[model samples]
Every structure is written in structure tokens, then in C-alpha cells.
Target: MTIIETAKMNGVDPLAYLADVLDRNHDHNISRLDELLPWIGHPLP
Candidate 1:
């Protein structure tokens, strides 16, 4: 499960997190998935 807790703990709004990641994460590799994680913000390199 994607930890909604991470979103909360990072002070990121859950809806915003979902929208952001979903909108841009289509091409992301599984090993680099942390880039889209709630705590990481905006698909970091």
C-alpha cells in the first residue's frame, strides 16, 4: 500500500499528492519510484 501516512507526515495534501504523481509518473521506473513518493516531492531525480 502506498503510505498515505507519508503524505500526511510530509505535510503534503493527499489529493494533491495523488494528482501530482498520477499526472507525471507514467514513465517512471519501479526502482526509481521513490521520486514520486509523497516525501520526495515533484519526482526528484
Candidate 2:
């Protein structure tokens, strides 16, 4: 019933599962930005 148990039962990679969960709830949508920025780049002011 726990997250690890469920993920394991479904044969999902733990890291990938965590990433997908985080990505689903990501606050920013940089993909829509006009300019592609490096992952460490600060947002325009």
C-alpha cells in the first residue's frame, strides 16, 4: 500500500516513478518559454 510497495508491484523504476510524480506537479512550464534556457538558468526579470 505504501509508495515503494506499489511502485515495486507495478515494476516501475523508483527513480523514474519519483521523477514522473514530481514532473506532474512541476510549478513551472519552461517548455512554453520563447527561449530555451539551461536547467540552471535564472528566470528573466
Candidate 3:
């Protein structure tokens, strides 16, 4: 199921649920790279 559907089934706000998931599992290296790519003018492959 899609994220919004899963969130509704679990009775949580979708955006909040997504944020929580990201907070719990996201890698800071990837996050920093994601933010930096645009500033570096290099598209990620």
C-alpha cells in the first residue's frame, strides 16, 4: 500500500509518519549529499 494509505490505516498523520520513518532510519550522509548536490551543480546518477 501507498504511504498515505498505510498512515490512514494506522491512524497517524501521513506527513508525520513519513517524517518519523525518515528520522528513525535516514542516513545523515545521504541526507547531506542530497542537500549538497544542488549547490554543487552536479546531478546525482
- Which residue window of length 10 is worst by lDDT in model 1? 36-45
Q: What lDDT score belongs to each candidate, Candidate 1 first?
A: 0.73, 0.47, 0.50
Per-residue C-alpha lDDT of model 3 across residues 8-44, encoded as one tens digit per residue:
6755666665565566445557545443322233222
Q: Is candidate 2 or candidate 3 better by lDDT?
A: 3
Model 1, span 1-45: residue lDDT tens:
356677888888877787877877787788987688776666422
Q: What is the lDDT for 36 in model 2?
A: 21
The Cα error of candidate 1 at residue 12, in Å, is 0.3
Tens digit of per-residue lDDT, candidate 2, span 1-45: 475566666566555665655554456566754222223222321
Q: Model 1 scores what on Cα lDDT?
A: 0.73
Query: Considering every candidate listed, which one attains the maximal TM-score?
Result: 1
Q: Hey, what RMSD does candidate 3 come out at?
A: 11.5
What is the Cα-based lDDT of residue 38 in candidate 3? Answer: 21
Superposed Cα deviation of residue 30, candidate 2 (Å): 21
In Å, residue 34's CA in model 2 sits off its true spot by 32
